[model samples]
Target: MFQTEYEFTLPMGYIDADGNLHRDGVMRLATGADEIVPLKDPRVQSNPAYLIVILLSRVVIRLGALEMINPKVIESLFAADLAYLQDLYNRINGNGTRSLKLVCPHCQQGIEVELDQPGES
Candidate 1:
């Protein structure tokens, strides 16, 4: 898988009594190409809020910044990761779901359908 690394400096104002933010003075990290591409695209790059959310997620995961472990944050992160994975899978595999399973709305019986090959007619 392709990957890229980026370094960013946290501002001084974020330091707190608990500890200094980045006592080492530099934060360097790697993210998958799939994750970085969307952020780099000019169409979406101008939005700082989305960038902040992505940066914070990376910081939280890389720095192990849990003061008190919140399950919701963990769940949110997991969901974000899963969404990224699903996007990557769709791009690489040519479609999102390889197969579909259908069940009766009332009785919940299992049904299965297989997707066509990548270039199949």
Candidate 2:
């Protein structure tokens, strides 16, 4: 059976204050309130983009040796890692396991693309 939570390795790991590199982690599928409740946060209201930062912090249950998963950790992550997680957040929550329907730009051929893997959009 499939699991609601998924494990992933960052393309570029998060380096903590102690200099330990954390590449392995797990994130759960976002619930409706997970996305909605953040809108009321002052941080989100002050800066719209901060939504993703907060959202990720909430869903990422574990990351390496870090006991506290907060926005600072998410913000400190490499751009590639952030992209990787965002793609994952959208994929699992957006369409489950089904491939997204699309058409080739050059060939104009219809295609089905699966964005199941981390960092794949």
Candidate 3:
């Protein structure tokens, strides 16, 4: 069976109220409702970027010792960490993978490469 959720480790990590660090977490595949309803949110309406925050908050079921997860918590993540999460989301939900490693037939060298998305110039 295909996996519906994936685990990731944050680079900077999230700090809880008592000073605990939360690096590991799980994010489930977003449902249709998850993506659509957030559009109605005033915050999302005012700022499209906030849509990721709200969507992630809904799908991220757990994060280390945190008792609850919410948009505020997702908003508090560092920019790099947040970008990492976004990449992870795209990798899992968009095409099931990001990059591939292959050996050059002529040079016998191995390299990792990412496929360009559609509409890229």
Candidate 4:
């Protein structure tokens, strides 16, 4: 069976009004409508960057103990967390390999590391 949902951990995490920290979350593959609908949003129209917030809100099904995820929630994310989500969104939705290229500092050798989404052993 094909997998559409992916789990991830934020580098910094989100802190709620109650002082709760949310790090782990799940994001599903984005549909065409997810991409298209955000474009029509007035906020996205005013600020193109706001598109990611809307798009992410649509795809992120869960975040820690939060019962709901919305644009305001996404907007409240730290910059690092938002960037992490953006990369995750591109990686899964783009159908690209979940591998990252790196160069070993000690050996000065190139290597590729396969990234496993959270919840995987």
What is candidate 2's CA lDDT for residue 115?
54
Ranking by lDDT: 4, 2, 3, 1
* Per-residue C-alpha lDDT of model 1 across residues 1-121, encoded as one tens digit per residue: 3222222233222333465442112222324643565587453477644543444344333323445322233234434443543343343345466677989889999989777644454
Model 4, 3-83: lDDT tens digits are 889899999998999999999999998899999999999999999989999999999999999999999999999999999
Write down the RMSD of all candidates, one decimal each: 16.1, 5.2, 5.7, 3.7
- The collision pairs in model 3 are none
Worst lDDT 10-window in candidate 1: 22-31
Best by TM-score: 4
Give the TM-score of each candidate. 0.25, 0.79, 0.79, 0.84
Clashing residue pairs found in predicted model 4: none
Residue 117 of model 3, lDDT score: 40
Give the candidate number with the greatest lDDT. 4
Question: RMSD, model 4, all Cα superposed?
Answer: 3.7
Judged by lDDT against the true structure, how good is candidate 4?
0.91
- Model 4 TM-score, all chains together: 0.84
Model 4, 25: alpha-carbon shift in Å?
0.6
Comparison by lDDT, 3 against 4, better one: 4
lDDT per residue for candidate 3 within 43-92, as digits (tens), equals 99999989989988888888887878999999988898788888777776
